[model samples]
Target chain A: MDLINSVTFKDLKAPLFIAWQINSECNLGCLHCCEEAGHPMPDQMHKDQIFNFLRQIIELKIPYVALSGGEPLLHPQFFEICEFLRQFNISLKVETNGEFIDRNLAKIFARLKFRSVQISLDGATKDTHERLRLRGDWNKTVSACKALIEEKVNTEIVFVPTKFNIHEIGELIDLAYSLGVWGVYTGKIMRIGRAAKNWDILCPSDEEYDVFFAVLNKKIAQYDGRMKVYYYPYDVIEELKYRLRYPSASLLVIPNGKVKLIGPLPFICGDLRKHSLIQVWENYKQAWSNPKVVEFAKKVIEEPWLVSEANDWIELYH
Target chain B: MVFTAHTKIREEKFGAVIFETLKEKIFITNRTGKDILNLLQKGSTLEEIVDTLVNSYSAPITNIRNDVTNFINQLKDNSILTR
Candidate 1:
């Protein structure tokens, strides 16, 4: 696509990307899953509702979408959704656990020409990886990653650093390089979902963060531009301020059709199920300044622990 | 039909991307949007844009007009275009 910048929220008619939580279902029980996926929701988005949202996205000229879930690939109509998106110029990115992405699925993903397929692999060593990813098969994840790379699909490993996995950051990067994947996307694990339950153990200590920065730089140098390493330096206070100051252009669509802010604010801007996308978007533009949203942002800033209570979206505005 | 100085347009393989320098925001358009932007960059009139689209694409003239109008209005609303 072409390059355009120097813009304000007014210039943005629609979200450039939609982080659609396709379903509240997953097979793996990751220790820090933000969606806390496993059991499927009975009232999950109906097929018609999903296609309706897809039509809305097309009408708005959305260019990008990320398909995520408890496990997005688990959606029965996932391939159909990909085919539909292929009809338009929209680019897709998939977030998967890599357990179910066998050779056939990997081939299908490659054929679809996704922008990137990010698979979660918290640890480099099998012992460490399984420890973080409860019920996760290390061999399956590695094999799935290898299959994607073999099929020439752009693959990136999503890693979460904690005290257990902090020391393995370099090794994980090395492993990613050896696999010949595209990139390594990692950051401080958000204290939400199951993570909040076990934060006392999963949260990395200050000493471990010192090792994280050093090894992260060392691996970047060692890779020598062969692989991309994306590390988001997450600071809650700064992020809260920035998010409040700058208007958000993207809307986070949860599996239940609730439109909320991208980061874990927990304030529901509008419900896509209740109104058309345009109406919801119109409301969402002003939602940041809505007293409820503003107060929550300020509260999160002052009492960062409030984020721990943000496991579910709170319906305040529509 | 020229884009304002606030906007910088770059042509890409799929479509053109418009950059608003003031806000440092980007607008990614599709191939059709690229075609329209190409005409605007050349200072083509709105009627000429419609005429060109009518000749080039198989869509009905009404749909084409609406799309062009909406695209233009969006840009104008953002001050990327003045008139």
Candidate 2:
């Protein structure tokens, strides 16, 4: 079944996962850490703060939330927070590096009932993987993937294609299948965070990604339902026009109760806490219809400075 | 301070633009005036507004100044301007 149907860009459902980094501390410093890894642990969110935010999210009736961190698992009360959030009838999507998803952790993951778990693996082989992740244990990450699948959790392998691992993307897809992940998401390398700092080494040129996603679609076609695929920025490629048409079928509730109008715009158009979901939607309608805002968006898409700001938080976690 | 909202209008010549914070919605008639209206807003001085239009739009400030002064007068004559 093709996940993407004959929908135009206007029809796609809004995004469901409002991805936010609750903390910036990570145990492993990957070479391409978008948020620029290896920073000291940030002031962890107090339990009350997170719970309060989740309550606001529940009040807003948003359907999903994703908590990321340098390593969200590293948070002292990570599991407790997850358990606390389960009462709200909201699906949780966890984007983790998988260094912490061992047997004991797998039990916790199962209990949380995460709708989906996305683990990052840059290369299909250990040699290439270790090189990109820097002190990353490929075997351990693979083991974690196997554990999640065995537990029957919907799992996705996220491959951030950089110059280092661009060539081995085909092999990585095979690796994802071997582990029985529900899908694999090979994302483009954005030149915003550390990728910007190490542009020469990390950012893949247009020619490189052309071959990467080409092979990816070919693999998707070959495997059929054994796996599914999704991309970031859901690029405006002609072949992918069908995917854009689906009204972004997702809604993101940030820690501060901000309902991002679209996937992580540089500016917050309205706060869900201060306004109802319908109110927020109205503001977006107003903002969209406003010529000034529309012009600004056109400029943002055409210019790098504004786009870089919206993606700045990605660099902080990298 | 409950501010009055004008009818939202657009002009293609000056590109996509929204002129708010003026008297009850005035439909900007000329493309040149639309270019000036893009920068005119609350708390903006005639001088500051003229400066932005002159530097950014690159249409002589004197020409824009006269247009803006006339637009403000028209709105005032229509009882749209408070101050």
Candidate 3:
């Protein structure tokens, strides 16, 4: 696709990736899952809808597409969808919890040939992990991680920082490296979805989350590029240090798509169903001067009431 | 197209980005004497970009269009646009 000559939102060259959440239904009901599994699935975008949607993505020539779900592996047409999307020359990333993996699935994963696979892990030990995941299978996750490693597939383990598991951050990092995995990425539990429902248990206060990142940073520094780590908000001292020392490994992507500038804010960039992608980007450009949206984003960072709530417990660790 | 070598156009800020795609240039300014320049991309139009922001942010249609018109003129006077 030829590059569009017009620059609307801050001279954007183009979008490089799009994170598509096809379905929100998942088998495991993890205590920390943001997608909260029991809701009815939204109507699946029909083939034509998907085709039309994909045409916009193709026009941008985004090199990567990360397909996520309550558990994306559960989609009945999982493989077929992969084959179809493969036609567009996009590298794929399948995000899953790993309970669904097996030899047959591994073979398919290897064959379908995604760019990478990421399995979510809350803790390094079975007891700690099972505690947060409720009925989750830690052994299965470990087995799946090993299988992907053996296959020489690019695999990552995503750890969501919560009150219960934040104390053992070092062990999780060591566990990932010991298994010969590519790297580990930890995200702060934003107050949304099922995570919001269990806020008392999941959100460990901003202070605690900061301490958790600090401890993980100490351990992470020892490896020094053998493995990589990324965190959200990009405000942590550790992350700033890491970026200064080795800038190439970290990156951030807008989950819905980077089509508009008004993204990365509290308000959504309207429904893509009713408008063309170009139209979406254009409107986002005009929204930059929106006083309300700008004010909201500022308050989240400046006030961050959530930070105060987590500060007391966080001091102990830091 | 109008031209002024050192015209300064007011730039607007977006979510976490800014509307600075139009580099400094010379162009025609509307009656309000605002230069509207460098807004068009290969498949984009001034109206289309304004419409997208309006839809995404749920802004009032009338106000956004009005601001866009002023912005367009500002750019035009700066000679930042080809058309």
Work out the TM-score per prediction.
0.80, 0.63, 0.64
Error of 2 at B58 (Å): 66
| Model 1 C-alpha lDDT per residue in residues A197-264, reported as the tens digit of each score | 87889889989988898999888777766888878776555666888888656778888888876456
Please tell me which predicted candidate would have the highest lDDT against the true structure.
1
Predicted complexes: DockQ each: 0.11, 0.01, 0.02
Model 2 TM-score (2 dp): 0.63
Predicted candidate 3 versus true structure: per-residue lDDT over B1-83, tens digit per residue = 33232222332221111111112121222322221233343345667756665765566978767777666564444354334
Q: What are the per-residue Cα lDDT tens digits for candidate 3 across A1-318?
A: 011223332343333345676666677788877556544355555556666767876675444667777677777666766776666646677898888887677777777666678899889899888888877899999999988877777788999888888887888889998998777888676554566568787778878877887887787787667876655555333332333333221112222222222212334443455566555544544444456545544554555543222211111000
Higher-scoring candidate on lDDT, 1 or 2: 1
Full ranking by DockQ: 1, 3, 2
Chain A vs. native, model 3, TM-score:
0.77
True-vs-predicted CA distance for residue A43, candidate 2, Å:
6.4
DockQ of 1: 0.11
The Cα error of candidate 1 at residue A25, in Å, is: 1.0
> Candidate 2 regions off by >4 Å?
A1-17, A37-45, A231-233, A236-265, A269-293, A311-318, B1-83
Q: Chain A TM-score for each candidate, in the given order?
A: 0.96, 0.77, 0.77
- Model 1: per-residue Cα lDDT at residue B27: 75
Residue-level lDDT of model 2, residues A70-169, one tens digit each, is 6777777677767866665456778888988987778778777776788998888999989988878899899999988888877888998888999998
